[model samples]
Target: MAPRNKEQEAEVLSWIFEVLGEKVPSGQYEDILKDGIVLCKLINKIAPGSVKKIQERGTNFQLMENVQRFQAAIKKYGVPEEEIFQTADLFERRNIPQVTLCLYCLGRITQKHPEYTGPGLGPKMADKNERTFTEEQLRAHEGELNLQMGFNKGASQSGHGGFGNSRHM
Candidate 1:
């Protein structure tokens, strides 16, 4: 189990509730999200119908299904596989921090969807800044040394001794 951050946990909880437009339930973070109902609802809110069936009340396996479903839905919605937390992380309370991280990542991914105008969490994602150059312009720079790389100004190592040689006084 990784070390938990109360502040980060609180922020994630607040963001989730804000997005879902619900009050934070009185309970531990893991307990509140263990059943995966809230997680399912969160993904649905971000991308409607992402989770087709949310098992509201059921046995452990069935409930874990909800977490799995949430994971799949978020993956489809653009959360990277690596960033998605395992079901046990939340359901088994093995790594609550990872679960929190997954939620934060989901919140961050929301910025990618223009239709999602709901509250956002974390720093706003930077927009893509793609620069296109003409063929001539690209060719023009082929032989030129990019100043950004470094302005060597015809530097050389003529005075420097090779490796293993000591410098003279």
Candidate 2:
């Protein structure tokens, strides 16, 4: 590939750092990088719009299903909700790249510690038959959200919020 200009390079590096903080400790860069790629792929499957969103945001951070899911999981699992909440916050704020990373972490936790089932067993328990979040499906969701958000933005920007001017109250 051709070498990126300074601006382009800076942007990429900035995104990397934004998603992976310095305090993440040393010796984990490889795993983090690997996980990031896997997650990007998974999320591309689950919600390609999230991928476009990360791109649109001009950052590498990954957006997942949403924090509410995790919050619910914490309640169900009876684990320390604070930890999950904080993690979800990081992903929501795009401080981390990809929300699936958090889910992966949670999945591992549940596996390693049976006591930690997370907040919502329903979603987790949904059999393999229902868990087909392919990249194509995600692309559809992205398209829908994009259209909705675009319409909202346009409508709002149009001044009267989609409705024409109103006479008397």
Candidate 3:
């Protein structure tokens, strides 16, 4: 095996020390030792603050310590992991700022989600107004109205109202 470079060793030591500092209580030597054992278990390497490497190889003492710590923390505190994560996620969801829309895709002013913009009949078309008219009745009514309005006489360049040719355009 190649000898460890000074810079790489320093970086790894710094990381281990940082993790130890976070995990261990200040002025507690035994807790510091436990942290070192956990770190050694983590990397399968030399324990920090020890003259010798720990001999218990392949055992997950680091993960075991973490589990013990987690259990202790939950016992001491009233909060669970699900509670914490759900609270954080709900905060992020509710904190999203509302935006104003300028011109809609249908060339009208409307509110919409940020990403989508296209020609649509919009929500008014989706609402059931309880007005019942069969297709045949609607067609006959429309044809009568068009004939009465002299739409077929070629007098008016604009056609009688229905769906119109805007969909084709």
Number of the top TM-score candidate: 1
Candidate 2's error at 155, in angstroms?
86
TM-score of each: 0.82, 0.22, 0.17
Score each candidate by Cα lDDT: 0.91, 0.37, 0.32
lDDT of 2 by residue, 71-118 (tens): 444345433444343433344343333333344343434443444322
Candidate 3 lDDT over residue span 21-44, tens digit each? 444334432233233344343222
Candidate 3 regions with alpha-carbon error over 4 angstroms: 22-169
- Which has the greatest lDDT? 1
Q: Tell me the spans in candidate 1 whose CA falls farther than 4 Å from its real position.
A: 134-165
| Rank ordering of all candidates by TM-score, starting from the highest | 1, 2, 3
Model 3 global lDDT (CA atoms, 0 to 1): 0.32
Candidate 3, run of 10 with poorest lDDT? 96-105
Off by over 4 Å in 2: 1-66, 86-94, 97-105, 112-169
Q: Root-mean-square deviation of each candidate, in angstroms?
A: 3.1, 20.9, 23.0
Candidate 2 Cα lDDT to native: 0.37
